[model samples]
Target: MRHFSVFGAAAFACALFAGSASATQEPQAADILFERPQLEKLKGGDRLDYSYSFKSADPSLFGPAFDDRIGLRVEPGDGPDKKKVEVEMFSAERRRAAGPFEDMSGNPLLSLMLEENLQRLAAIFQANPRYMKTAIRLALRNAKATPEPSEGFGDAPGWRVEVAPFKDDPHKARMHGLDTLTYRFRVSEAAPGEITEIAISARDAKGDVLFEETTRYAGKH
Candidate 1:
């Protein structure tokens, strides 16, 4: 049997909806662009993987190379049974100083600029969709999600995923820097394999909403 991830099935459904009329519409910047999720069945259990790309409406004002910050939250089951899971998909820390600068050893301004440049490079690296995808895959692979017995409910599946936070650095700092964001996923045997709802939201460091979208899942299972 051919198995698919929630995102993969969703993409297929989207493609079907994109009839000839869609071809005529000009491409515009979307708040979020997500790739189909890939499902992997292992000896232990099943895994789902997905990634997204986003473009802020005001990127230039945010930062020279700033991209949209994406967030993912997964809740399994209905209100009573629902459990919110936190997935750490991105780092929240700024870049740090590069290796020791030999030529410009004494100069402070050059050294500061060098550090900033390194931070920019790091930002670009993290922003790369490919890099982010690979990182997510690796994280899932290394995760030890061993199911444990649930309280009051016989043997229930429960897995824990540990994600390391970004390292704290003293040197690197930028004005109006982008807030670090994280992503996570959740699955419940009781809930349908399909995602029931999808939400996209953007916020500043102060917790102000910049953009938000909440809707029922349009993708197929």
Candidate 2:
């Protein structure tokens, strides 16, 4: 499962969509990205084009309290705007990990492998479109809160995720000799297309932010 806990915590959401006009609603987190028209063409097992950038971590944050910036880029399947998008690019950054892990940097080979693995993951994600729905479903199953119903548009209401510090290492202090850690994300409402807002946390599991930051979507093309 390749760290399903971390992936689940980070990749929760990204599977909701609705074209029907409604009212003002809250946004939900997503594991995949897609445009309105692209979502329409989905058959239960269709793949989607997806791209995203992770926020570079500032060494200063040095803890689960540090903010993790994440961006999602989705290309529609086949429609008038199949190549276009509703939100175009959705970006957000929030704290995810509070403590430091074994920085494989000490080993040049391992560091290189990390980079290669990341690229491999990207290639696999793009080649296999079914990953979109699979990622979202996995995230939802791991979320602490249940998904909320949507009212209208904007930020589809009904999704929230909460994270607790690690039981063995509450402060996430590598100095404290921490072991494995796990956090939780609760779903309140689900944003269909773009992730309008997210309030997830990272810690030793004590509900503390070694780093934290909130971001907004600029609807950038």
Candidate 3:
């Protein structure tokens, strides 16, 4: 009976095993972005499907563009990174999300992508999901991860972390502009649970896309 999101979700094996608490864990684009250990380099049943898109621009107060997925499998443990995970959020058929299943070492698409985008920005700015998770953990502990390797999606080895936790919010006009949200993460080890992407966007003051959400990485079927 958790699921108020900003995760406390564990069921289907605790969001891909031990990838929750510790202020939401996941992905690997070094130099910070939730510490390290991108999911014990993966194993068991090995799945990590993603593709949970979202969109806004006021779909009558943020709601519209939809798509869902964040499935994971992996179940083998007792050693070697002690895994035993399972997740399947935003149903489309594979509805899992119940509770109980954890072990260690990060990655569960980093707490189901920032606790489902801070539980939709704490219900569209009513705020206080622990002060929006301490302002996105100080914009991901002062983020920085550049590396950008591609090789046409095959050579993989990528990295790209960006932050904008509320752009110097001293409370930023009550977050109307949502302090111009931006929180990208594009990790890669050529996929297989290494996070090929995760995104969140915001725009205003003349730009566009008031809100956005992405998930990417759709391999490992």
Models 1 onward score TM values of 0.28, 0.32, 0.30
Best by lDDT: 3
Model 2 has an lDDT value of: 0.28
Which regions of candidate 2 deviate over 4 angstroms? Answer: 1-74, 78-144, 147-156, 168-194, 203-208, 215-221
Q: By lDDT, highest first, what's the ranking?
A: 3, 2, 1
Query: What is candidate 2's lDDT per residue for 39-94, written digit by digit as tens?
Result: 33323222222232222133333323222233223343344323322121122342
Residue 184, candidate 1: Cα error in Å is 3.2
Best by TM-score: 2
Worst-scoring 10-residue span by lDDT in model 1: 27-36
Q: Tens digits of per-residue lDDT for model 3 on 128-213?
A: 87787767665665555677785348656677888888888887887888888888877766566566777889898898889889
Name the better of 1 and 2 by TM-score: 2
**For model 3, which pairs clash?**
10-99, 10-100, 11-99, 12-86, 25-110
Off by over 4 Å in 1: 1-127, 138-179, 194-202, 211-221
